[model samples]
Target: MSDSTDLPRFPQESSPGPTGPTGPTGPTGAAPTRPGTVNGAFWAFLAATVISIVSGLLVLGERDSLADAVRRSDAKLTAQQIDQAATVAMVAAVVIAVLIALLYLLFAVKLRAGRNWARIVLTVLTALQVLSLLAGSGGSWIGYLSCLAAVIGVVLSFLPESSAYFAAARPVRR
Candidate 1:
C-alpha cells in the first residue's frame, strides 16, 4: 500500500442492490440550477453597492458640516485639530465603506455560485448595513435607497425557493 493512504477500497462493480439499508448506489445527482430569487438578490446587492458609492461621493460636498460637527463634539480642539480629525474620519469612512462594498460583491458572487455560507454571511451583513444606515441618517434619500436594496436582497435570499436551491447545492471536498 502507498504510504499516502491506507483506507479500504471498494470495487466499482460491487454496488449493493436495493436490499442494502441505504438503497442501491446510483448515479450522482446533478447540480441545481440557479434560482430567480438568488439572481434578484444578486442584482439588489449590486444596486446597493452602487448607491453606497454615489452616496459617499455626495457626502464629500458636506465636509464643512462634518468639520462643524466634529468641532461641536470636542470643543477644546483647535481649528487645525478639528479639520485634521474630520479629514481622518472621512478618509477612514471611505476606506471602510470600500471594504464593505467589496465584501458585498464577493459574497454576492459566491452566493450566486450556490455557496450556502455566503448566503448566511450576506444576510448578516445586510442587516447590519441597514441598521447602520438608519441609525446614521435622519432622512437621507440615498441612504434610504441603499437600505431598501439591501433589505430586498436579504429578503429574496432567504425566500423558500432560494433556500431550497442553496440547500440543494452541495460541494464536493477533496
Candidate 2:
C-alpha cells in the first residue's frame, strides 16, 4: 500500500462523507457585520486626512490674500515672514495628512484581512484617538466625532462574527 504521505490530500479522507439530505441554499450575499471596526477606524482617519488636506489647500489658496490683510493691518508684519509662515503651515499640513492616511490605510488592510497583530494595533490606535479628542481643542467637534467613530469601529470589529471572519481570512500558519 502507498504511504499516507503519498496519498492525495482530501477532506473525505479526514472526515466522514455527507450522508444526510442537504439544506436549501440561501441567497448569496456579503456577510453582514463582520468586524468592520477596522473599516470604521480607516474611514475616520480618512475623513480626518481629507479635512486636513482641504483645510490646508484652502489656506494655501488664500495665503496671498491673508498676507495682504495682515500687511494692511497695524501689526505691519513683514510680507516675507507672512509668505514663509503660510508656506510652512501648508507643507506641514500636507505632510501630516499624507502620513495619517498612509498609516490608516495599512491598519485598514490588516483589520480587513484579520491579522492578529492588527487587532492590537487597532485597539491602541482607537484609544489614542479617543484620548486625542479630549486633549485637542474643545471647539473641534469634528475631531470628537471622528474619535467616537474609531471607538465604535474597534468595538464592532471585535465581535464574534468579525473575529471569526478575520481568523478565517488570516493566513494558515504551516
Segments in model 1 whose C-alpha atoms lie over 4 Å from true places: 1-30, 133-139, 171-174
The alpha-carbon lDDT assigned to residue 24 of candidate 1 equals 29
Put down candidate 1 lDDT per residue, 1-174, tens digits, no spaces. Answer: 567468787677844322222222223444566778999999998999888888777767778999999988989999999989888878877887788788889999988877889889978887776778768757488888988998899899899888877766643111
C-alpha RMSD of candidate 1: 6.8
Structural similarity to truth (TM-score) of each candidate: 0.75, 0.59
Candidate 2: residue 123 lDDT (0-100): 79
134-168 per-residue lDDT for model 2 (tens digits)? 67654255456556656666776676666665554
Instruction: Say which candidate scores most in lDDT.
Output: 1
- lDDT of predicted model 2: 0.59
Cα error, candidate 2, residue 110 (Å): 1.7
